[model samples]
Target: MPVYHQPRKRIILLIITALALLLIARLSYLQLVEKKYSRLADANAVFKKIIYPGRGLILDRHNRSILGNDILYDLMVTPSAVRNVDTAYLCRILQIDKTEFNSRIADAVRKNGKVRPSVFAGLLPAAVHSRLQEGMYLLQPGFELVPRPVRSYPYRAAANILGYIGEISPGMLKMERYADYQSGDYIGLAGLEKTYERVLMGQRGIQYIVKDNLNRPQGSLENGAYDTAAIAGKNLQLSLDIELQVLGEQLMHNKTGSIVAIDPATGGVLAMVSGPSFDPNLLTGTERTKNISQLLADSSRPFLNRGIQATYQPGSAMKPLTALAALDEGVITPAFGYPCRGGYFSCGRRIGCLHSDAGHADNLRLAMSHSCNAYFLHLYRLMVDSDKWGGVKKGHARWREYMASFGLGHRLGVDIPGEHPGIVADTAALNREYHGAWNSCSELYVGMGQGKVAVTPMQMANAMCIIANRGYYYTPHFVDHIDHADDTLLRRFREKHVVAHVSDTAYHSVVYGMEDVVAHGTGKGARIDGIAVCGKTGTAQNRGRVNGVVTDLKDHSVFVAFAPRDNPRIAIAVIVENAGTGALFAVPIANLMMEKYLRDSIPLAKRPMVERMMK
Candidate 1:
């Protein structure tokens, strides 16, 4: 019988031994080497809590806090742990009706199963939180108070620039870009907050605490060996001068336009004001949803950052680029001039000029100072019809390249978002619009910034910077430097950008003309006593439809200027929509901004003018 025994029996025994060894190894791994399964098993007796770090502070150039942190508390509830709770007493403590309380409980249970925690009431004030905390034990082991840092604006002037934070949306929670965020996390919604969200939103930490069988937290597991400490956000030091910002906002009150000022040296935004802007605080705390809804519903669109979002025809503000183009191409010179009668007549159309019949705009200085429409129109035609390029299409393409280099007809790559690249009509576009029969003369309106070219106040201000810096500019930005941040975030703005390949002499000639503008030309209203202000006034033609019929409207007042011609500190662009003229409206606002910034005070003599403009 021993000799006849089959080898199959021995093989089966070996296989059974191997299976037992594998099972023991796996069990050993589950209990010791790998902790995931054990953690799952212990979940009933362990609580994982999220620790939110403090957001960075936003300070102005003067070291004054524009936005600071405030302590806020949230009431968290564990649905499954709730028992023997007084419904009416809890509702009274939270200041919610019975129906609302029930609805919240239902929502919590629906969102995060019965065993998990959910927000019962969030962003509670210090007073309300203290009162509720004193009576928290009355609600049993279900509710706990969690503290968080909330945004608080002390100045409250830069609503559009500082931006606001809001709770993460369902869409945001699922996106890979916002993977770090949970359903209850708050994120920057707009403006600077949105731009520097990563820097402002610090890393969140987690703590694992031991709990009893009854689902009550006892102490930290293993003395907090698995706990992660929260890292604080990096603080931002902005280039904005709060005093100047307040002044600009005040000057723009009751108006329907925008003002953008920048430090040409560093491309730092000094003051940016968009009229009809609501308070930044309105978008903070618990009332954000309701406030945002109302703001969105409003017709004026206060949330619109007109400085970068709104595009205008640019009027004579664009003429400086035209002059630069002609000078750079050698089609015209600082010495070139054009004679004008009442208006310019070409291609069977008459384009009116404010500087018509004034004198021979014999040089770029006179042409730009007077904002001679005929002069620029002639220069534009010469630029696009030059024999060097052989055809208007080729010449216009060259012109578009120059505009792109000037940061026009495209986004300036500002730090914030929602910027629109203004329309710069291309050759194909021109052909499509004109049935392939267009020439330089056919698009003469483009010369005066009226046809297809558009610009934002931010672009206009940067263009002025190009002139101020003499053929080069730094990409405009608001933050001068960020504390504890690497240069990668600000390196692009620090790099110099050149435009049109124009000579320094050409830029100097343009500067001389702008100076004359403030001294004796259309921009006389922007003159400061001791400071040499260089400026260009523009009146953009506007049209709108009223009652389903197209109608002509008042011109948009536009002005671009910089002070102290030698070493320019500030460059500004002002656009007053539908106002009479740049000198009448935009000039004064610019003057006040420059004066306040330069001297730290508006002269007593300028008080009356300020009052009149305020009225």
Candidate 2:
């Protein structure tokens, strides 16, 4: 019995020795080879902290405030880490009932895993933050109060232009491109916010801190040497003039159209006011949901940016472009005259003009000044009738190219989003629309900026800029620059684009005719003394008929003008829907805008028309 016991004991001793050696080797490997990993794990247990850099400010052209930062707190919670705390206490501190507290906790857990903190409430006001900061120690172990900057629009306007920020949806979070963004991060949703997100959203930073088992922060591991500091977003300098913008907004109070004014030399947008605009502040804070609902429910669509979004028949505002095209194409000369046979003209068809029965004849200058329909109709026939016009085809294809050169029929590449490219009918499109045949009658309305041609007020303003520039124009821009550390944020759209079909001479001729328009022609109402204001008036007919006949519908009054014929400064486009005639409704408005821009103020009595319209 003693001999057998000795053998078994030796075997058991050897096995125990082998086990000890293996354990020692594993410990040595962990301590030496994986030293960094073990050290990080140890550090994470003692300290955990995060850094948030505030968003940058957005200023006006003069460095005046448009959008600024407001300090707010975001309450976050880790569902699994919350223990022994009364839900009632938490609810009381949060100013919510038990139901809301439970719902919020459940939502947090559902939206994100319990391993990390999820946002429970966001954009809490300073007053609310003050109340919560006192009771923060009573919160859950893994809870956090992150100080963040929320966007604040100080001007309370440019809602469509300044845009708003919203939380990134789960779908966006799922995409690898947005992996850096957490579940509660805010992102730009529209307008300039959406357009220049990269420049506006600064890089996020991280910090390593040690925490105890109770999840309370202990201290920094290496005195913040391992931390990355967030680079603040660049400050944007917009070209908008606060005073001018406010004035324009006031003038458009009761109207339903748009007015866009641009510095012709630099293509900087001075004022872009669309009727039915909303307050930008409404889209920023706690009132967002209610305000959005109100805006959506309103019949007037106050949120729509009519300056860049709404497209309408440009009416006679398009005449200058058309005239330039005709002159450039060599289809018509300045001296070429077309007779207005009373109030109608039949080119083997029954197409009639508004002044046909009045019986007048006009050259290019007189025709444009008077806005004579017969003259343009005659020009349209010659343009489309390539067979009769000596093989010089000035049909839809040529006309479309010329119009495209003026930045029509396409997006103008403006800094703002949601710009309409507008509708332009080519031969194929017209044939498709007419279901097989396109006639000269189809071309008649287009020459007068009716039918298939439509444009946004912004585009119309851009066209006027091109005309004012005498052959070329810089693309309109709202932002002039962005201030950044590495000079990486300064962005300017300074590219010049030439109006293709028209030459400098052609532009000059058109400009001369427009000048005459204000001096002695239909646009005389827009005349500003000592300013050399050149303008064109449009009275576009609507689609609806009054009686059995298509009565001349209440027209959309339009005016496009610039000052100081030799060297233009400000170019503007104004449109008033169902406002009779351009001379009556739009010209006076243009004059007021001109006087305001040039003289820095308008005479009260001279603004009678504007006051009447306001009433």
Candidate 3:
């Protein structure tokens, strides 16, 4: 061979040697490192089964499980494996028509594709499950029974607060957060379930099943060697008192409104009831989809959680806050008096007073006790038009700021979803609304808990907490502590939220006045046998468009209160929609709830009152 041919031969040798090494490395990686294709290639010979963990339990203050789980069967389907099966017999066992059966199979195929299994008929009834199980072997390869755990409400209370779970949607599949989740996976849809999903969802496990030629599960693949264990979700403990919750629900039966009770010290919600509530069980098992559809179609909107979602005028329930704002601004003292004869005419529009007597508002304490509309209207005017903050615009702006600090005008960041800020018109908004020419008198209705102001039952209840605690409040919450969860998930709830540095004297006057109201004034209905209940009544007017004109619907009966006066424990707000007056319905319900929570049992004498309210 020539010298040039020798050089070419060496180059060819090096190239061949490098090619051999590359092929060896690729084969080693495929055989030992890459596990993607090591599984049985035939879709019928092996199946990947997802083992879902048991979802978290929700307990009450007493550690009693309020929301747990129940086992139900889902008829899972692998669309491609469907062969010669008795479709009509299977549909009969499942209690579905041929069209419905075909529709479900088509849907499963569309959702998860032909190779994967999806829920054909989920959350089967016991009778259906038994019948289907007996015939399951005949329906081999296509459909199989898979156990699924669903939520159960033992007491059947707190439907809106506990929320519901549903299957993951297609849109969610495209998102990175839901990457691990498959089609038809159950997820929390609302309320506390939605709020703590990450902590409560736990971990899902995978198991490979060995299958015969007929696609029947023979046993665990590889003796379960490749199986992963499912970890159960962490439990959650709420501050709720189930007994109190039961009582509130009973009292609110047939009513469309809300009742929110909180621990004054911790801001932990004891009971939050949104009336026209259905049993939480309705959203689980066989009846879920149909019941949800019915609920959604209901005219009253049973899912509208009024505690934080609905907003209304504060009515006379706002007098105490107005008084506090004025006192804090130094525009009024406890001794400041307002002489009223049925109404306040200073605004030249006549903001009417409930009590017509001239002596009804002789002093701040008397005014608060009587809920004299004229007195509070005057105080609101004094704050916004005081010339202390340069102009009424700035003063009004400052007043709104004070209210926001009091947990008004914005979302309180409650654990639940869909909380409305409740319409605290800003200065710019006011300017746009009133065309840059307005004063405290322009919205005197707000001072009397009417007009441009709107508030949620949760905010009102939290405001009661502020007064009960003398100027500070915790952000109202349901879950007190999550079992096995880190403190990082709950630090915000543990921190204190101080509103203003109002003097103790101001708090004393307001508390004493509210006490007097319960003792011998408009809130007399809220009086308990031994507890010093400080309360205020409200008849909040509701308006809506009728045909074309705006007209008044029935006024909402509202009441806000705290128990024992000194060292208060429970701060509560109740609103009964379309009810005539606050004293007629809201007062009795609030006081009854307080009594039940404090005493744990009602006296025989109060039994009649409970019966009447429960009606």
Residue 14's C-alpha lDDT in candidate 3?
A: 100
**Candidate structures ordered by TM-score, highest first:** 1, 3, 2
Candidate 3 overall Cα lDDT vs. reference? 0.89
Return the lDDT, model 3, position 368. Answer: 88
**lDDT scores of the candidates, listed in order:** 0.87, 0.77, 0.89
Quote each prediction's TM-score: 0.93, 0.88, 0.93
Clashes of each: 0, 14, 0
Highest-lDDT candidate: 3
Give the per-residue lDDT of model 1 (tens digit) for 415-526. 8888888888999999999999988888777787888888899999999998888888888888878899898998998997766579988888888988999999999999
Comparing 1 with 2 on lDDT, the higher-scoring candidate is: 1
Per-residue lDDT of 1-615 in model 2, one digit per residue for the tens?
678799899999999999999999999998889786676566447443455666667787778888888877888887766876656666776679978887888898788655456788787777777877787767757567887778887777777778888888989999997888887778888888887787788877777776677766667767888778887887788888776777677777778788898888888887888887877888766667778899899999887888899888988778888788778878888888776764434655554544553324457777777677767766666676656444323376777888898889899888878889898877678768878566666567788788888898899888888888888888888888877544333333677786674777777767888898899988888887788888888876666667777775677888889887878888999888778788776787777777787788877778776676565
Q: Answer with 2 or 3, whichever has the higher TM-score.
A: 3
Which parts of model 2 are misplaced by more than 4 Å?
A: 1-48, 84-86, 93-95, 140-144, 348-361, 387-394, 485-492, 544-554, 607-610, 613-615
Candidate 3 residue-wise lDDT, 19-67, digit = tens: 9999999999989998666653545577889888999999999999999
Query: Lowest summed-lDDT stretch of 10 residues in model 2?
Result: 484-493
Error of 1 at 601 (Å): 1.2
